[model samples]
Structures are given as C-alpha cells and as structure tokens.
Target: MRSSVAVILATFHLLLFSGFCNGGTVGICYGRNADDLPTPDKAVQLIKSQNIKYARIYDSNIQVIKAFANTGIELVIGIPNSDLLPFSQFQSNADTWLRNSVLPYYPATKINFITVGAEVTEAPNNVSAMLVPAMQNVFTALRKAGLHRRIKVSSTHSLGVLSRSFPPSAGAFNSKHAFFLRPMLEFLAENDSPFMVDVYPYYAYADSSSNVSLDYALFESSSEVIDPNTGLLYTNMLDAQIDAINYALMGLNFKTIKIMITETGWPSKGSPNETGATPDNAQTYNTNLIRHIVNDGGTPAKPGVAMDAYVFSLFNENRKPGLDSERNWGVFFPDQTSVYNLDFTGRGVVARPPDANNTTISNGTSWCIAVMGASEADLQHGLDWACGSGNVDCTPIQPKQPCFEPDNLASHASYAFNSYYQQNGASEVACAFGGAGFRTSKNPSYDSCIYATFGANGTTAAAGNATALSSAKPSSSTAASSGSDFGVPTRGVAFFVIASVVALLLYL
Candidate 1:
C-alpha cells in the first residue's frame, strides 16, 4: 500500500511540473486586415509549425478563439475601443461580455492576457478616460469567474504617450496625459499586470536617419548615445526606448510595474519615398532584435530583467489605413511564409536539406512550395501564375508525367511553386503567389514527383523517385525548443487539487 501511495505522489508531482509556466523569447502579433489570409485553423497550424508559442489578437473573435482551443498557444485577446464605454459604464456589460466571449473559451483557449483598449492615451480624452474603469470592470468579472490570477488585464500605449524619450535617463510622459496615465499605472501595479507599450525603432530611424545610425537602430554596430545622468552604455535603440519607459515609470514613482512590448517590427516594403523600408533592413532589424532579447537580459538600466516582447505582426495587413509602411510591417506574407528567414532563438538561419555530411544546410539552399492550407482554387491560380507569369517549368506535373499521377492541387502546385521558387534565386518574393505559396525546409519530393530545389552548387535537379515528402520539423533554434510558454501544457489547478484530495482519501 505504501509503494502504491508513493507512485501516486510521483504522478502528482509530474502533473504539477507539467502545469508549470514555460518561457519564450519571441511572440508574434496575428493581424487580420487582409482578406486573403488563411483560415484560422491553418493560421494556428502555421504558428505551431513555425514553433511560435505566444500570439496577440486584436479582438476575441469567436472563430479565432475556437481555433486556438487546446493548441497550448497563449493569447492576449483584446476588447475593441468601441466596447470601452459600455464596459466601463456598467459592470454588467463587462460581466456579460466576459461570460459570452471569454468564459466559454477560458482554460481551453489559454487566454492569459486581456487588453482593455489599445493606445488609449492616443485616443480622444473622453475615450481615454474610460480606460481604467473598463479595466477594473474586466478584472472584477475575471475575479468573479475565478480567473483573475491567470488572465491578466492591461492596456497598450504608443511611445507618443511619452513627452520625452531621449537620453534614456530623461524619459518622461507628456505631462498633459499624466492625469489618466498615473491612475492607469497604479491599477497595473495593483493587479500585477504589465504596462504594455508599442515601441518602434523603425519609426525613429525613418524620422531622423541623420540622427539615428542605421546600425544602432537595427541593434547592430553599437550605440554611441550614452545617457549622462545614468552613465549607462547603450547598444541599440530598442533597449534605450525600453529604458526610457522605465525611467518614465520611475519618474512617476511606480517602479514596481513590469513592462511588456505589445508591438515592434519593421516593414519589408513601402512607398518609394519610404526609404529604408526594404526587405534587407526589415530582416536585419527583426533578426537582430530577436537575437538580442533571446540571448541577453534587459537593457543597461534594467539589467537581468526578462522582458516579454511581441513582434508587430504575422502578415502584411493590406486594408489597414495609414502610411504604406503601416500596412507593410508584417514579417510574413498572407500565405504564411516568412518574408525572410528568421532565427527566433538567436541562432543564424539554417538552410534546407542540410549538407549530406553536416546537419546544417548551406546558406544558398532554397525551395518553393504551396502553403499547407491554401484553397484548391487558390492553389490552381498560384500554379497558373508560376507556370505562365512566373515562367517556371511545369512539364513534370502535366498529364502522364511523373508528378501527374497524384492528380491533386497541392502536389501539382508544390511542383510548380518549387520550380518558380528555385528559378527566382529562391528569394522570399519568388514564392508569393498572392498568398497561396510558401517556402519549405524539407525537400518536397516524393515517389515519381520530381520537385525542384536549389542545391548549394546553385544547380537544380529532379531527384527521381524518393520517399514521400516529410514535413519540416521546426529548426532546433526556433523559440519553442528553448521553452516558450506556448510550448507548456496547462491544466487547471482545480484538477491537481482534486486529484490530491482523492489520492489522500484513497490512501487513508
């Protein structure tokens, strides 16, 4: 009986450990202003496939929430600005909203954070005034549902909320907005929630390229701007921006509140006049930023602190109104392929197929393929573009050819997309067939299906009959492998508590 009891205790300990929080260095914003984006299921799959663990969505859309259920992806869902007045004016409204929108999908969906309003200080004063009240009501509702401990409540602000940001130590909020911000900061501190803020080095660099070195803004080279007050050395604009915010919080005497980066990213493409918004610059900025945060602690001012950051967006939002740069801040195209290869774990990008002798593929490796969740019609359309407009060889996928026996949209499109992807220097843009294609790390070759891939020698070949294409495992360097919260499996504490009680009763 004692032995059996010992085994039960061991199992209980395993359960508790499984529920412990996992850490992640990177998260992505899931913005859906574009109509051609993949279905929610597909998008979530893509996120998981990419080994992404944390995601922030603008609203608690039912489809999106339902899709994320049981996926272990921690979400920070939002309440739209329009709902602020209603949520704040009446506790019942907030309660009802949570009951209907969130409670139905609570633990299953892993909704860990709630943003009452985004950039409230940037809104009209009247709207900004409702922010805290709405947050309190939401928090109350979560408490009533007995979820306040797990699902945090907070709001996101633009750096525009700060009146001063230079000289990291001199950071201070615009005095005019202090009336609302001070109380908001208090609420965040009381609730143990973070003061979320959007920081964009891209904007800073664009506005004053002469003043900001491109290398410093991109987290490269080294920061020459040292704050005289703190005598701290700075290496990147982002760390400085974060320190500025920290200084601002310290100025207000709210030193205990944590900081969360709600959004930050560079645009891969923009209007002709939007200089430095090229793919190379975007890649450099995001890659280096990810590497810095993953590999190091906090900035000079707040060294050793582990900060939470979410990249601006997953896909370019075509319908969002603003400068061309605003719509182009996505790291991915709508088809769910990287705009550029990124190593979220601070390691360099690894090539596909890897070398025969070594596990890492050479830098020149590339492949083209249809995105997994693309529609049949979209797949056909993309295939057409690749063969006709893209001028990729489609002979292998034609009737009676090696690849034609599959007679499927995905197989044929993969062949054609791979061909186009290989021919066009295997660049990211080569696979974008209006959001129907993506890049692959695994060679998508199968029996009698001769897909094209760019080898290290810069030559293409039909590798004849081979095993069915294996799906690409996420690179070891992806953030998930290093223990992201999304990779953690969560079970309600109630389960463990109940199990312990039951085991005790049985043992006695």
Candidate 2:
C-alpha cells in the first residue's frame, strides 16, 4: 500500500509539471544507441534519484513507458526517421504505431511530447520532406485516441536548416528546405506545438575554433558578441542559436510558435582533434547551461521567455558510430554513475557577483598570466589592451622572437603582462587587465619563452630587449598654453580685470 501511494504521488507530479514547471525544468535524453545498457526500471530509478522533472527517449519503448508510470517524470518520446515514411504514408500506420506504443501508458507514464523525427533536415535520404506529413498523421492519430490536446507533436531540427544564423536577427531558413519547412511551421502553429531544435555549440566551435571562443560555447564567458542590427548582446552560443531559430520563425510571420531545445550536450571524450571534449569541459558546459536556463533570463532577442531543454543523453553508448565524441555525450556511464558531478536543481553552483577588485599580488616575485577558463576573445582583448594602453613591449611574442615559438594568445598575453607588471613595480593596478589578468606565484617560463620575476632590489632587468613604459599616472593639469591662439600670451591678461575696467569707465 505504501508503494502504491508513492507511485500515485509520482504520477501526480508528472501530470502537473510535464508541460510547465515552477522552477527551471531540465530534462535528459535517454538514448540507447549502444549494446550495453541497464533495463528500463533501473534507468527510471536513476532518473528519480537525480530529481529530474523531464526526460526524453529516442523511441516509444513500451518497457520504458511502463517503467515511468506513476513516477511523475514527464517524457518527450521520439519516432525514428526510418519509421517516419510509414507514418507519413498512412494514418493507419500512425494509428497502429501510436496504439501499439503510446496509447497503452501515456497519461499514466506522463508522456507530454511526441517528436516525430530527430533532425530530419540533416538526414541523408531527404527525410526532411516526410517530417511534416508524419507529424500530421501522428497528430491525427493522437486526436482519434483523444489525447491530442495533452501530447504535442513536432520534429527536432538541426541549426543546419537555417541558411544564416550568425547575427541571430538575420537568421533565415535555407531556401532549398523552405518549401517543406514552411508547411511544417504552419502545422506547428495550428497545433500550438513548439518548434523543436537540437542545438550544439560544440559542433560550431569544433568547426571553427580559431574564430569561436571556448568560453562563449560553454556559457562561461564574461565577454559578449552583440548582434548589431538588433542590439542584442549574446554572452553564450546556446542563447544566440535559440534566438537565431526564433528570428527565422518570425521572418516567416510565425511569431507565436514557441521553441524547445530537444537535444543539447557536450561530449566528455573524443578524438585527438576534438579539443573541447574533456570531462571537465563537459561538466562546465552542462552545469552552466542549467543555471542559465533556470535563472529564467531568456535570450536578448526574446527576453523573459522561459526555455525547456533536455541534455543529450543519460549514458554513453559505446557501440555508437562516428568520431569518439559521438559516443560520449552521456551524463552517466553505462553503470549509471554520473560521468561528472552535477546539481540538476541548479543550486549547486550559485553565481557570485563579479569581483570588484583583482586577485591580490603581494610585494613578492610574481608573473602576470591569463586567468584560467578565460575565452580566446577575452585573452585577445586583454593582450591588445596590454600591448596598447598598458604600453608593454610585445616584441618577444612576435614571429621569430624567443617567446613566439609558443605562438598562442594566452602565452603571449602572460609574457607581455608580466613584463608590464614587473616594470611598473608589480603594482596591483598594473596587474588588473579588467580582471583578465592573474598574478601567478609559480614561474610560467617554458622552453624558449622565459617570464620575468621581480628582483630583491625591487627592480628587475629586461628579459632580452623588452622595454616597459613609465608607471606614473599622467597629471590632469591643463596644457601650458592653449593651442587656439597662434603664439599668443594668454597668461598675461585677465578677462575678469578687463571686464571690470570697461564697467567702471562706462559708469563714470
């Protein structure tokens, strides 16, 4: 009887919060694209333990659906792209699939969304054409079963469907796919279902690491890229991607259709070339992502609009094909242990206000270095400022110079900042490059690039021809002579004295 009541309560929570929640709701995608995985019951237990309110699965697996019954976890189920053709061809096929899969345990299981096709636009067989028809048939089947209003139907799309996404405000769907996408948008609008998108900054960063900063991709950057046209300042890539999709939809005159992030996660491991696929990076990305969404601050283009997102997967699928990153998006290993610690509730890593002052540097030997986790753009910004305003000699970081062998922004910035800091008596003001600079106790001297350290006499010699600017604060005194008059003496005459004499003469 106690077990029965627990199940009933779980069911109640699922029913109430499946569509919307009081706090920021994050879901997990339980993809079983591998040979080894636990049974549905054990997976459900893990989900419950994490206190996750939402979950999405690749298929309408009967066992998984039944396992979720009375657990109160709302689910977004998917229909594979291969099955889309059959569903699109005939309503009977859709009804059969729905009856065999979803109808048996929907409300009890808390199924709220049925994604007909996953990223169909990127499918090789031109499955994009069948997405709308399949969605329609699925909707019709749900209506027949008297569940259309409760369960929304839509297909997940990749950002590749959009021809332009850079400026966010200028995002537009590719003209080639617009024929099919337009009708699909209409169907979604008519049904009030969201336009689901699978957004991944990892892919964008991987393709163009030189131009895109890692901090921007991971939602950890203090710097922002503003869309000039819309005056929208985008601090992270995910929000920019979402706003791009929204702008695309609004371009088509479908302003009311909402957007949902059906899939988004970072891989914990990958090939040698996949530089950003480390476990630490994965944790940082996922954790920060949850906090950003839960804070209820939507994208700049669509302020205050709440978002619903599902992390890519539950467990890594070893059998999955493609690059190493392809199989490692899971938050947990196959054993159900989390790959990295995460607070799904978004309270674990509370954001602190920006430090008003920079890291303290005692009057001892120290090397000014780049702050860890600072973005490439941020490093560049600081480097430029150090070389320009800070007046630090950066010749060592130039090509053919000793420090140039390392040839990276961070390394160069460190060398330059250290030179400036040491020259300026290592003052606290000189070391703070808008918080991008950090004072390192350990020497960062590497192979050919040796950083400078302070001497006992409080002044250090130059590390090879590097010169430093004076640390003196410029006086605010006005220029000795105004440039307006050519060789005129303004100090000898007083305007007030001349005015007084003219007034006295006039009175007499």
Using all chains and alpha carbons, the TM-scores for the candidates as numbered come to 0.66, 0.66
lDDT tens digits, residue span 1-508, model 2: 5565555556545543432332246899898888889999999999988888899998988888999999999999889999988888999999999889987886789999999988877787878878888899999999998999999999888998999998999999999998789999999999999999999999989999998899899976768899999777788899899999999999999999988888899999999999899886787788778766664445778754678899988999998889999999998998887686565755342111123233564555666776654667877888888789878888878999877744456567777778888888877677777776777554455323456666778877566623321111011001112211233323333343345445654555
So what's the TM-score on candidate 2? Answer: 0.66
lDDT values for all models: 0.76, 0.76
Question: Cα deviation of 504 in candidate 2 (Å)?
Answer: 64
Structural RMSD, model 2: 19.2
lDDT of 1 at 89: 97
* Residues 305-345, model 1: lDDT tens digits: 66788988888889988889878888778877767655454
Count clashes in each candidate, considering only residues at least 3 apart in sequence or on different chains: 3, 0
